[model samples]
Target: ILHVTLTERRKEYEKAKERDAELRNLRDTAKLQEFFLQEIQLGELWLARGEHKKSIEHLTNAIAVCTDPNKLIEVLEDTLPPHVFEMLVHSIPYTLQV
Candidate 1:
């Protein structure tokens, strides 16, 4: 009976470990997307500095990942820096039309 209990506990531990690994992968994916958002935010800085070409490129890519541009703009607005929000907001109307 003791041996059986130990085997069950080991199985539970292995399952927990597997869950942790999956969670880690999910966390990494979130981090990568956050990095992309940061890039978009940085593009706002470029626009402020009159680097329109690079700014549009980065913003375009960011909007592409956004399945719902309107919803995404709303959700991301408060989280982003003010100028970044400005740029995203400015671009959103055009994206909706497209």
Candidate 2:
């Protein structure tokens, strides 16, 4: 009986922790959205001005913070010049948020 009670308590504790984390993420959503937008805009601006290296840096940062990097990459691929998109792919870190 004691073992079963302890197991149940542990599960409840884990669920509570997950809920708290979700709440914290929700609170930070606005800040994250702003940052993501800034990075993407800066990247696009630099790319338009023919600054390949700077554009790659900003785009890589955007990808790193993105929750859905695959979708973002698809959009970028469709929008960016092929060579520039290739550069971004190479520069993007393996440790993406997604």
Candidate 3:
């Protein structure tokens, strides 16, 4: 019975470890996504002010950090006004040259 209890406990410990690892990965991904969104916003602000260079810098940073381009586009589409989103999309070509 003692051996069986130990085995059960070990199994539980392994499962807990896996859960913890998954949680950590999730937290890290969330942080990255937040940072990406912030960069995009900063880029948009720069673009609005006619600071194209600064806008490109931030947009490039956002693109670099994007793990899922589709999700990034979806978030931008949902969060930004149409004109602002269009400006952002337009800036991408210029960003690639920088």
lDDT of 1 by residue, 2-41 (tens): 9999999999999999999999999987986896688678
In model 3, which regions exceed 4 Å deviation? 68-98
Ranking by TM-score: 2, 3, 1
Per-residue C-alpha lDDT of model 2 across residues 9-82, encoded as one tens digit per residue: 99999999999999999879978989999999999899989998899888888888899989999999999999
Per-residue C-alpha lDDT of model 3 across residues 1-98, encoded as one tens digit per residue: 99999999999999999999999999999999899889989978987897866776787679767877667667777866676667668776666566
Clash pairs (backbone) in predicted model 3 = none
Q: How accurate is candidate 3 locally (lDDT)?
A: 0.79
Q: By lDDT, highest first, what's the ranking?
A: 2, 3, 1
The lDDT per prediction is: 0.72, 0.89, 0.79
> What's the residue-level lDDT of 49 in candidate 2?
97
TM-score per candidate: 0.51, 0.68, 0.66
- Which regions of candidate 1 deviate over 4 angstroms? 2-6, 73-98
**Cα TM-score of candidate 3:** 0.66
